[model samples]
Target: MLTSAPPDDASPPVDAGRSRDAADARFEALARMARGHFGVSTALITQLDAGRQSILAGAGGSCGATLAELASCGQTIADAGMVVVADTRADQRLRDHPLVIDNPCLRFYARCPLLASSGGTLGAFCLFDDKPGELDDEQREFLRDLARLAAMAVESDSTAARLQEEADALRANEGRMALAIAGSGTGIWDRNLQTQEIHYSSGWKSILGYADDQVSNRIEDSYRRIHPDDLAYVQASMQAHFERKTPSYEVEHRIRCQDGSYKWISSRGKVVSRDSEGQPLRMIGTTTDISAMHAMSERLQQSVDLITCLTDEVPGLVFQYRRLPHGEAFFSYASAGIWDIYEVSPQQVASSAAAIDAIIHPDDREAYRASLDTSAASLTPWDLEYRVQLPRQGLRWRQGAARPRRLEDGSTLWHGFITDVTDRKRIEAELQEFATTDFLTQLPNRRHFMKHIEAELARIQRNDGGCAAVLMCDMDHFKAINDQWGHALGDLALRHVATILREQLRKTDMAGRVGGEEFAVVLSDADIPAAMAFARRVQQRLAATPLAEGDQRIALTISIGIAVMTASDASVDAALSRSDRALYRAKESGRNRIECL
Candidate 1:
């Protein structure tokens, strides 16, 4: 809480000697009126802060309490500025009000706003009862009127001090102007035509980190703060300012602060007063911290240096391209690894975009175009890998990505980087091929097969004119071949059987290696009879194919089973189960036969 010294009672009374006397008399009358009307132990009139409506004065000890203690009463009474009675013993909202629950002395209370001369609520006048009671509306109105009169007297006392305050403010402005012109611990000089002597402020000595009393109040003494490199130019500027009536002077140079550290400060000043002969007389100005600005300038130069170094600094190709309306166009972007990736200089590729586009793999150009088209239409980011031809070398894979932003003219500009990703792309393709195809037969593996099954199931579900049939085929007598001609011969026989089956199936049918000796086929648009016929053809083809090894021709046979899939099947697992059951029955019936389930 901020506390101001209480006004002296003996200095001047409001009525007898000054306006305060009248204010006291007015407040005394208000207290009498409130006490008579409220019939309470004490009736007090108080003032409130203008910026804040919290009670600043009261009848007795209540005025001494900080605003935080009053809580809800402070907000309610201060804002509404009307008669409010919190009879805690009877009113539920205030039954547990802080004043009643915490300090039993305030069981009932009534307060009416004290109106300032401007008609703003300044504070209140009220009576507190130790027991619950209420004040009627008429009595409340009477107390409010009396409080208004008391507030008016307070305003009258404030009016008396207005002139003295204006005088004090004018004196403060003069001091500020003098100090500013003198400069804060900064040396300033003026020539007096009458004496031909220079005048400087105490700051002149302090600018050099010297005590004002220790240093002679001379212009040269203050010049000690200027860096030796800038002292000559600064001296010359001052000479020109005085000789030509330059009106103003400014310089950003190093200065010695109080702690003896060299800090950069810009001191600026303008002539505030001059003699009748057009000669400069007085000046005023300020010094500002420019260390941040200097640091930023230094960082900007460093960034330029870094960019200059990057032209030949890195290893991999670092090229940039901008997307244009016709297609993605290459500007004069740079790369350090242009020679390494494409056996060409960055200058050559930057100048000729058609030459760069010619390097894209013939098969991958359409894919690259589609990606660019999608990105341009949506204004979305794009990343793609495409093969580029290298001079006298094989193809190299390059990964290019661009971030596009829409311009005000409804055109898109893309900022993109191209990097050599041949090694990474090669590795990724190997991994993907390994994941999707069987190693031994080079056919679609289980993971890829399940993807096809799901697509076919979805198509059937959508009434897209296709029922899919899954044919599970197991090599017959494969263990016997391994037992007779060794595992190598048996492996050759399996490969031969897989090749024969693939050739026998239609182009629409997908064949996959599902297990050690088991294979699966997804036949599109093939119902139960069609699938059975296809399975029989695969069985007969496998039975006829002969696996050729070192010196032997091994004959192979396949037991085939087909399952026509329906939408009611919960998952691929259900379809595979049905196929497996059919395969089991096919094997039980006899080897080299086709069965449907």
Candidate 2:
């Protein structure tokens, strides 16, 4: 039945001499074409090994080199397609190669990679010469087309050999196969299905630590060693085979070893021939030790079960990630719970991880990609908390953590979890806002404003070269305006001042409503002159803008007091205190006037 169906791990048949001759003949035609078209001295088709290449065919001549000695094909192979180097000495990647530095002193080189169907680089078709040259777009494209044809030829040869191999393997003699199996540390058995008895080879008895004569050839003798829990399944398998339900008798079970412990084994067999009644007349099989495989499978099962339970009960997603060497990525596994968080199915993300990228908030996508690149570069764990936007859900914050590893083939894989942290983030933001930001103005309140000032001072002190200035502004006659217009318009007027502060100030500057009708600015790295200039600008802008309600327009003005963070001012409070006194002086001199201290 293995011949009736394709096997999972069958390799193609091989004939060293004849296959080599056929390969060389086929490639010689191609080598000739390449040499004629490119006018190169050497044209060869090669097979790449880990640290070397074997020249299969050539025009002009062919030779081999250790990869360390000259890996002239390396660049083309890595690129996985055509590469043209105009001058070998000008190419840094190939400049120091022995072939370039010494003999022939080859100057021109162009090669196209022979790609395998499985996406691995096999080797290259190369053209080399002493004269420097370059290819135009049409010539480069022509080389790629030739490489594709070469790949098709390789695949055709392999497929024919594989078919022949399967036919031969199907007819391999049972006695010879059994003898071979025994030599390879496997056990063989022959069974009479009608008699319900089996003859086991000496190797089978040895596997269980039984003396050859101590074990009987009877099937019941084998039954005694099988684990009790496997008895019913074994009986069922035999019955199904008798009914012809399965193609063969293949089962995995634990058998009691001689020391009274179990060892997992895989039994594979087929009915060799059938009687006139269509019953199985004879069956032969081989047993392979699978204790290590069983243990690993059990551990894997535990992990799967754990994730399944969490997918149903937990509020998040879990996944296994695969990233190929060429930057293509997919999710090998994703929990169904992702649908709730991302409004996308596990299958969708599994098929293409780009679907997840599409839903991530646009503002955060660059950061997300950057984090992955950085993590891959450093081989560090990736940890990110970022916002994602959904059409229905609006914006939400998600926390993600993944451990990344580089695989042998140069790809990277990550095992990660993503959880909905929106509620927690919201709570944290509220708490922080209440502590530092003014409820009415939505600007930093007094406490946080002072903290900002403290930080700026620390930065200025460390750098020891930047300037700083502070401005104190109070609504002119704010108490009288509140008395006449009521607290509502008074509140509106305060908001008006806060808006100007936000719209006019640079991002580097910080402004806060430090108290009722009192606003302040901390200009980082601003000198006394810059501070006065800013104060004058605010004076001009506010004088021109006014607040209106129900056809009533009220003109407004603010008096500003400015002070610089000079070398003598050790603390933010000292600058603030000076600005406050300056404001008092400004109020006494004239309302709407700018005063500096």
Candidate 3:
């Protein structure tokens, strides 16, 4: 029901063949104006030939039934020259029509006829729809007026055949162009700035999940279909183009379909023509899919940014090198931290092979060269650890590992990791010291002493060296001292004994406090008599000093047992057991004494 039930006089009369093109152009303009007032896809100017008496001048999708059919039904208003379809199915004449059956999607249509100057019916201006609907009297009169204007344009042509020829040619070209655009997978749109009218191709409507016939004149309809997040940006770009600031523009945006899902599209557009004053008259645009491309670009940028940040922030020298065409090494990547770690800038490292070679310790230079030679000759990975002499930082260790890559020109490329291992090397040395020495006394502990004893035995066996002795000393009444003076004074006495023993021992001997109140000393190059003499000296020293606690004098005695291991001694355990037996005997004989095995 798209037709108006208005009086015929409401619309102006038409003249024939005077200004056909001008009249049709006016019809197009009137449609553009009426779009804002009453939203519709388009208002068209059509003419049926003289033989087609029923629909000669006008046509509408729903109400433009055959003239004989409408006449039989008494539904036509010749005076007003308008046809309306309140509801396509409800109208008996149109329910079984071919348009209704063929295009089940369309449910409404309306049209108004225009008069020729010769008082003959020529053509009509029409509005079409896929919906069945009613139009009020006011809407009907407005549509009738639009039809009258369209009729004037058509009849102004010199002959009806000429007018019809132009229409046929225009439609043929438009049809071919529409097919091409649809196949190209591009959405096309035309916007008229002066009239605020939009002409969207079928492909464009398909992108938005709508039939081309369903489009409305309102621009807000297009805006609402765009994704909410992308709406502002699209609007801003459009405004900028409207201001004549940009001649052409491109933007990536998201568009929402009828069911409310969004797809990423790349929009590209150009302003085709401008007013005489240089303002934009119309713009044309197309949209293409770019979601996958944008995603890959973003991922690549993230990876590059991550690598850049990590290399800049990490400590120590990091170098990667590849072999050049000739057998020379050339740096590919080096971090800024190389300057801090090597006291040599990356620039110096990359300047020449001799520059890096000069920094290597003399002892390691030849070995490093051999390693590189081996790597270049074979496909195996290169891994080497060595020391370097920094200009000011003394000797530092570095570890390098690389894999060989054969390039297109038969040249080899070595990508590798180089890190300063100085701090790790220092920590390892400290750990080895801590493992062997007693933390409190700074003397070799029981474990280290045993190891040294075994070494001495091997030395004596191999070289027929003289025997050494193990001196075991036990403090007398040491527990009683702790009870009387508290453990602090007892600690002081133990330290005193340790100091005296150290002063008494030769540089070749090793000493350690193995247990509470007990100390052992190994005389590496001393025989039995010499060991006995040394033990007696330790005993005498222990007795001579009476350790004091705040004027409370405490006399202390020590028992010493010396086990002498001959050059032929088989095991250290036997020697240690013999020392224990002698020590018990010395305690029994009298506290301040030394006994030998």
Best by TM-score: 2
Candidate 2 global lDDT? 0.75
Question: What TM-score goes with each of the models?
Answer: 0.46, 0.48, 0.44
lDDT of 1 at 353: 60
The local distance difference test score of each candidate is 0.65, 0.75, 0.68
RMSD of 2: 19.1
Higher-TM-score candidate of 2 and 3:
2
- Stretches off by above 4 angstroms in model 3 are 1-309, 322-330, 353-397, 405-413, 462-466, 504-508, 536-557
| Candidate 1, 425-494: lDDT as tens digits | 8898899999998888888898898899888888887884557898899988888889999988777776
Clashing pairs counted in every model = 7, 1, 17
* Candidate with the greatest lDDT versus the true structure: 2
Residues 1-597 of candidate 3: C-alpha lDDT, one tens digit per residue: 213322343232232333323434445455544442454433445454543322222122224443233222222223445777656667765676555555565465566666765677665655555566678987886676555555555544433355356547777475666666664446778888788877777777776677867887567787876788889998899878877777677788887776777777788888888888878888888776555445534644665577657886777555677676676775667777767666766677574556678888999999998998788789679899899998788898988888775664777767667788888989998999999987766777888888988887888788876777888888887889899888988888888778778878888888887888888888987878888888777767766877776777777778888897767678877777788788889889977778886
lDDT of 2 by residue, 1-597 (tens): 112112324312211222234555767777766675666767767665454455555665323333222233333223555778888778875676555665445778888888876786666777777788898886776566556556655554554465446547867665655554444446878898778788877667777677768777678778888899998898789668867999888899999888899999888888888899898888888777767546645644665587588766766888778888888888887788687778888778776789888888989999988998888888899999988888788798988899887775998888788999999999998998898889899999998989898888888888876768889999898998899999999999999888887877898999999888999999988977888888887777777788887798888899989888765567888989999999999999988988899
Q: Decide which is better by lDDT, 2 or 3.
A: 2
Answer with 1 or 3, whichever has the higher lDDT: 3
